[model samples]
Target chain A: MDLANTSLRQLASALHERRISSRELAQAYLGRIERLDGELGAFITVDPEKTLAQADAADARIARGQAGPLTGIPIAHKDIFCTQGWLTTCGSRMLSNFVSPYDAHVIEKFAGAGALILGKTNMDEFAMGSSNETSHFGPVKNPWNLAKVPGGSSGGSAAAVAARLAPAATATDTGGSIRQPAALCGVSGIKPTYGLVSRYGMIAYASSLDQGGVIAPSAEDLGLVLNAMVGFDARDSTSIDRPAEDYTATLGKPLKGLRIGLPREYFSGGVSSDVAQAIDAALEVYDRLGAERVEVSLPHSALSVPVYYVLAPAEASSNLSRYDGVRYGHRAAQYADLNDMYERSRAEGFGPEVKRRILTGTYVLSRGYYDAYYLQAQRVRRLIVNDFREAFEQCDVIMGPSSPTVAFGFGEKTGDPVQMYLSDIFTISVNLAGLPGLSIPAGFGAAGLPVGLQLIGNYFSEGRLLQAAHGYQQATDWHRQVPDMARA
Target chain B: MALTDTDLKRLARLARLRLEESEITGLQGQFAGILGLIDQLQAVDTRGIEPLSHALDLGLRLREDLVTETDQRARFQSVAPQVEEGLYLVPKVIE
Candidate 1:
């Protein structure tokens, strides 16, 4: 069997059964990366030597009869995360050649869980753009169609898993980064409630909206990775303290009597016809399993896009200030004075989309504008949050499309920043409300692109969300289709 | 459709971005368009509703103000394009 096509569960079983050495699995994945990553642009950094060493260690542990669910599993992380020995550029030239001396709490937890470090995937610089095109490195191509675009920010991570370069990869979402790409690339992913996963070492991007989560073959695998990653980390003041529980415990739970809330607003906007049909199909799967659909309303849901643009960039402007030429990023080789040097360095380091966010962020946060723009957006943000709280009172979970449409062509919306930002419209409000959200394959669109259905849950309701997704997956086969895994 | 030189420079300084006149014009147009869209939220009536930064009804964690020492100044500086002593060095700013 091709190890690269294998799921995390199968790989773990192979290691446990001695059918494949953990080192062999690592070597196979490294070989796949070597073969496919060049055209796909799925990775920014791949340390094969270290990965093999990690694999050897895992094999030794297995030999000693001590291995957990994820032990020896090879995975990658979005470039946004800080990896101690590797360069964590977050797909920007500003931090180019910047090596993180310490690991983010997520990375530390993965290492502790005995997961092998495959490499770091590419993303929109600073997680600003919805398409992977914004990365300084270049756009990541959709594995499904190399000519088209992969979804952004976490686009590289989703594409990597879709391309079978890695069985799973870690990703971050600040306004739909994880869910959007997972939708476009036909994979399963979850964005845990804000603060559910530690953000201590990930580079800040719109700090309040940013959340780290996992993308994998199935929700069951996502549960395994999340169990290792989520927990309180003192270094991150936003980290929440909660008792650990197995996320996969209810994968087999019956779906009878489950209340799935369908928000009218999520289905009313610019969603494509194919995407609507897909959402309807996904609903039917739940219905077949004895789940009932309940109508719900989030009056402020349509305002999410407007509110996110203001608040996200406002925080982005503040968080990105540290990258000034003076602190740690690139600086000009020659300058007449300090001001010129700073200006030139920033101009040279940041890309167009990133530069736009910094300016918008600055505008909203400016002295007189703060209250009118930033604070007002914050207040409207509460109405959106409260809307979700009210919806959950009527149903067990809220469902919608992860994005308004499927992946657009590469360079399609790059010229228009407003159009580009709207890609996250369906996904951002969850971050605003700090609610947990999940994206699973609904079905394929007319162009044969993947469409995602989102499930939003109440605070700390990740277990219920996963249970619902798991139940849906049990009733559907779309989640199991392999992507060109046997092509080569 | 594009930002004037004056607005560009002001926006740059506001962001603390320190951009050149050339960079400002390109950035300004993009910001205007983006901001124009975000302006739609202004239509929503949310008077008296508190601004929210998180969904949970939680308060900040207060920790005892104390130094927790774990130094690897050398390690922390590994990503710096240039560094000197225990601090990061930059283009000379003190006139």
Candidate 2:
């Protein structure tokens, strides 16, 4: 079997039928990572011994007729999730030497289902930046073009799945981290409703906005993995205690009479011509599949980027205060006193973008500016949420361009923080409103780079969103297009 | 909305980040641009709308006050920067 081309479902079937042992599957991916990842910079950690040991245990389970759907399946995890003995860097130097002593809820769930840890992928520092350039290890190069970045902070996971380094990867979305990268890498990803997935062990970025999700080759594959990922844990205060869901249950459902909302602000001159054309083409396919297009106005959309910059950083500043050269993470070599230790340790540990955000967050939350900046941003945040609620009244799912353009070259927008923040303009509002959103490869754009068509659904509408995306994937082959470099 | 050097220093101090003298000017420019962008929020009238903190409006869930966790202090402290005698070491605060 061509392991690289096989889907996650097909791999599960082969594993269950004993056609391919989990050990062999893990070794194949390990070999590929060894060969190709040197150029892609997608992974931060890979332990063959740990991987094989888990695979052997999985093989034992399958042999004993106790296998589950995810048993023996190798899945890559974004380094943000703390895996108990592995280095959980969160793409930052602060935690470079810190080994997690306990497993994150996501990791525990996957381990319980008998999944194998393929490796830990790279990401933006503390999940702060739009591009992977903020990563302390290095930027994850887009598999489609070596010079361009895979969008981040889930850049590594999206790039890995796009290159077939792993069938799927666990990722998190604070503001379009999963969808933007997935779109740029020509893969599929989903950020479920705010509290759908437990955030127990995941390192906090912006507690209000951060969410864990999955990046995979197809929307159908995302469903299978998300089934195991979504659950409640008392450890995470925001985790919703909803009944267990079968995320893949609606994958085979038809898209007849589905109302696909097209937010006018998303298409109103912000997106490049090529990306707009690709989204238009995808909409045509949806029309052919018996879905109706409805024009909706998210009038407060333009303010989302500004509001997000204020609120996300405010939350981040508070969340990041724990890294004070105190218990774990990086500590300065020399310090005059405790205050100096905190100041110098943070100065040395964080990258420019992280520092910039911390400062911005601090400025906004300061005494005089609190009412003007932080609180006002929160009030405006409600308007953005209400816009979505009103628009959803007219449609089942919203569709738009995931990013304004395709994968951009490294340093293209790095110098300007505002430009980089705008990269997530299309995906940020959903996070603010706590709605489910999915992005799938629609078609190729300028320079043959992939463009993604985003599908936004109301709260707890992941099943419908996946069904809509699966409908599009069934009619198109964009998600299957791999980069030429990975073919070798 | 532009921040002066003094303002920058104050923010850096509040955030507990030591900024080199040379990096201050560049950071100021970046901050000006970011603040200018977010200043757009000032134009919106959010007079009486309650600020939405949690997206789902979820209240804090109360739990039983019970000791559910065991002692893993050694394992947890293994990754600490400095540890001795089962305690994390930090610089002396009192002179």
Candidate 3:
């Protein structure tokens, strides 16, 4: 059997039945990553010594009957999360040589659950760009089409999972970082309600909107992982104090009487015909499954991209101020004075996209522009949130296309920053509203590329969203489809 | 909303990013594209809407004033480009 294609659940069962040892499974995946990742560029760091060591620990636990569901399950993480002793680059040259001294709350949670860390995946620099081209390491290739970009800032995570380099990977969404890539690469990914997962040691992007999530092959796999990833940590001031939940409990629940809201604005222009057709087809399957589709309105939806560009960059400018050639990260090798060191270090370490965002962010929050840009964007953000609140009153969950188009060729949208920003228009409003959103592979779009159907749930409604996605996956074979590179 | 070279340079200085003189002209065009997109926010009617910083309605969560973390200066500073006596070294500001 091809161990690479096995789901987390199937792997768990195989390990429990003594059919495969954790070390053996780890070896197989490590070998595949070693051979295939050269072309895919899905990982930034993968150490066989460390991977096997973690698997050996899991094997010992399995022998002692102490294995958890995720024990021995190999997974990669976006480099955005700080992992102790690993090069947590955040896909930037700024931290390329900097090894983290600690683990993020998400890393700790997964480790505590006995999940084996295979390696760190690449990402957009500081999670800034819509495409992974901003990564200093080089852009990650879409597993389906090598020339196409795996949608980003979590592109590497999406690519890794989609290519079966690992069963799943942890990703962060500040805008559509998680969901858009998951859609573009044909993987299931979720960005939980803000504060559902702690950002304690995760590198800051846009703090208020940034939420750590998972990218996996199927919604069931995501549910299995989210169970271990959620909960509050006092270390993160923004972490929510919500009770624990069995995120997998609602999976396979009957879809009867389920209210799936179709946002009229989402179906309007901006979404390509191929993507729209795929989403409509997925809705038809849901309708057959006994779910009700109701028309809803998110009037302020069109403003999401502009609002996100303003607010995310503004927060990023403040958060990134910490990287001023002191403490750690990149420092200028030569400088005339203190100010020169600060400026040179940032200019040298950051890529063009990162500098662009920092400049835009600075412009918005500047002395005279604050009210006209930053404050206005914030107020518009409130209107977007209110629109979602009103729409939720009419439906149980919102559904739409996850990205405006399927994965495009590298440099296709790079010339025009506005064109790049528009790619995320479908997925950004969910983040602006602080609602939990999931993207699941629905069907193939243009050029036989995969398309995703997005499900946006009210705050703390992750279980319901997973259940709805899971119900759809059971009736379809899309989630079961793997890219040719991953097939054998 | 049209960003001139002077405006771009000033913004870059405030952002603490040192862009080369040659790179500024190219950046000016890119910045113009982004600004043109975001400028649409100004046309939005937000008179009664309050600006939201956080997505949730909850206020700041406070904790007791107690020591929760132990010092790990050595471990934390291991990755620093330059360090002495646990202090991060940089071009002198005191002088």
Identify the candidate with maximal DockQ: 2
Stretches of model 2 off by over 4 angstroms after superposition? none
By DockQ, the better pick of 2 and 3 is: 2
Where does the lowest 10-residue lDDT sum fall in candidate 1 chain A? A479-488
What's the TM for model 3? 0.99
State candidate 3's DockQ: 0.85
lDDT per residue, candidate 2, A189-289, as tens digits? 99999998888889998999999999998998999999989999999989999899888899878999999999889888989999999999999999999
Q: Candidate 3: which docking quality band?
A: high
TM-score of each: 0.97, 0.99, 0.99
Which segments of candidate 3 are over 4 A away from where they belong?
none
Residues B6-33, candidate 1, lDDT per residue (tens digit)?
7677877655566655655556666678
CA lDDT, every model vs. true structure: 0.85, 0.94, 0.92
C-alpha positional error of residue B63 in candidate 1 after TM-score superposition, expressed in Å: 3.3
Query: Which is the winner by TM-score between candidate 1 and candidate 3?
Result: 3
lDDT (10s digit) by residue, model 3, range A1-488:
48546788998999988899989998888888987999999999998899899999999999999999999998899999999999999999999998999999999999999989999999999998888999999999999999999999999999999889898899999898999999999999999999999998899988889999999999999999999999899889888897899999999789999999988999878788999999999999999999998999999999999999999989999999999878888988889998999999999999888888888899999999999999999999999999999999999999999998999999998888889998999889889989999999999999999999999999899999999999999999898888899976
On TM-score, the leading prediction is 2
What DockQ does every candidate get?
A: 0.67, 0.90, 0.85
CAPRI-style class, candidate 2: high
Once fitted onto the true fold, the runs of candidate 1 whose alpha carbons sit more than 4 angstroms away are B1-3, B18-25, B64-66
Residue-wise lDDT of candidate 2 within B9-86, one digit each (tens)? 989999999999999999989988999999999999998998988779788889999989999999999999999999
Provide the lowest-lDDT 10-residue window in model 3 chain B. B86-95
